[model samples]
Target: MTECLDAIYQRRSVRKFTSDPVDRQIVEKLIQDAQMAPSAGNLQARDFIVVTNTAVKKKLKEAALDQKFLVQAPVIIVFCANTPRSSRIYSGRGELYSIQDASISAMVMTLAAHDMGLATCWVGAFNDADISEILMIPHNIRPVCMLALGYPADTPDTPDRIDASKLIHWQSW
Candidate 1:
């Protein structure tokens, strides 16, 4: 399989991480690569908050349904969407597209980290108000997801996939 395909197949949502700290430089590079993702008309409405501070991580952990793994991981990246920027392009449909854009960016960042010998977990279950307060996200931006990153304590095998036959169709649904 091609390297990119291999990475996609191998990437898993790692919930356990070692105490080792991920390099700041590498994290920056991954974030940069994530921005290369296609956005709605290249508006690049997605914004990221990189949390490396312990206190902030702790607060985020509380906001994130008491997910201690978030605090244990060396890095936590919060992906947010700038609705106003996206709204300018697509009008009524901008909100949906902007959400899609942000989610794709977060997924890419997680896969990139896996390819770089790191582990990450994408988190979406949380209170928006608490998250915004904890992360200081602006009202105009909507939080899409948060990623917890570090070296893996354990890597689980790939989860089962649905039968392709059940998902694929010829021309119409």
Candidate 2:
């Protein structure tokens, strides 16, 4: 398989991490890859906050349903969406679209990190209000998700996936 496809297949959510830190330049490049993801109407409403502080990571871990791995990871990226930027044109649909934009960007970042031999877990269980208060997120920006990134302390086997034939439909379901 080609390198990109190989990376896609190999990508997995890693939960345990060592204390080693990732290079700042690599993290920035991953963020840049995320920015390249397509956005609705090209509004590009996604914003990211890279968190490395111990206290903040601890608070974030609490916000994220006490997921201990969140604190263990060397970096946590909080992905937020600027609702007004898309809502101006798409109205009610914009709110949802902006969320989609942020999610797409997060996925791109995850894939890029995996390609670089780093590990990540997409975390979505956080209390939005709590995270907003802890991170000081702006009222206009909604926190969509968080990604915990670092080098893995353990490698996990890929979980079983449903057969493609069971999921695919021809022209109609």
Candidate 3:
């Protein structure tokens, strides 16, 4: 399999992370790679907040349904969408498109992290208002998701997935 495909297949949502710190340069490169992901109308409405401070991460852990992994991870990337930016072009659909853009970017970051021998867990179950309050996210920017990134502390068995035959539909549904 191709290197990219190998990385994609091997990628998993790592929940437990070690205390080892991730390199700043590696993190920057990962974000830069994520920027290359396609965006709606090329607006690139996604914004990211990298939190490494222990205090901030602790607050985030609390805000994220008391997920201890958030605090254990060395870095937490908060993905947000700038609705107004996409709204300039798509009107009513702009906000939705911005959300899609952010999600795509976050996925790219996850894959890139995996390829770099790092692990990450995409977290969406959080109180948006609480995260915004802790991170001071602007009102116009919506918090879409967060990613906990760091070295793996344990290897988790792959979860079962639905068979492809059951999931795939022909040309029409």
Candidate 4:
């Protein structure tokens, strides 16, 4: 239980990455770990697109509102929600659940990467249509978030968090 909580506290959004290359195998391992996250109705309605090509990264950088640091990372993992995959089962609620599934998986992956001595930054600010066009994603798949993955070049200081009592609601809001 402590090990689980440790990742939550220790993980930081690392933007500075070393020039070292992240092996495909390691990235694959991270995805595998992320897949362990529970999905609604066990639909597992999500997909991870691993991007290593610099040309593509440049396009993604632009799509991400010119976040230059994204190109510095050796790998970028695009977290997508396969809406149709979920919608087939749950109809109207499936789309929402698919997004949740993808988000949960991404959260799990950030911690898994942290545990494996790697750093990641969750990049969510991006043009959805641009990303989909760049990635050549199908109609059913929606790009929800991106993960910048690489070895750390600089360690960031811990960020401040809101007080639990202030943020959390007990029985009602």
Provide the overall lDDT of each model, using Cα atoms, as 2-decimal numbers: 0.89, 0.94, 0.93, 0.95
Q: Which has the better lDDT: candidate 1, or candidate 3? A: 3
- Candidate scoring better on lDDT of 1 and 2: 2
The C-alpha TM-scores of every prediction are 0.94, 0.95, 0.96, 0.97
Which of the numbered candidates is closest to the native, going by highest lDDT?
4
Model 4 alpha-carbon drift over 4 Å, by segment: none
Q: Show model 3 residue runs off by greater than 4 Å.
A: none
User: Candidate 3 lDDT, tens digit per residue, 37-118?
Assistant: 9999899989999999999999999998999999899999999998999999998899999999999999999999998889
* Model 1: per-residue Cα lDDT over 67-88, one tens digit each: 9899899999999988888999
Candidate 2: what lDDT? 0.94
Candidate 1 segments whose C-alpha is farther than 4 A from its true place: none
Rank candidates by TM-score, best first.
4, 3, 2, 1
Error of 3 at 101 (Å): 0.7
**How high a TM-score does candidate 2 get?**
0.95
Q: What is the lDDT of residue 155 in candidate 1?
A: 72
Measured by TM-score, the strongest candidate is: 4
Clashes of each: 0, 0, 0, 0
lDDT of 4 at 90: 96
Question: Candidate 2 — which pairs collide?
Answer: none
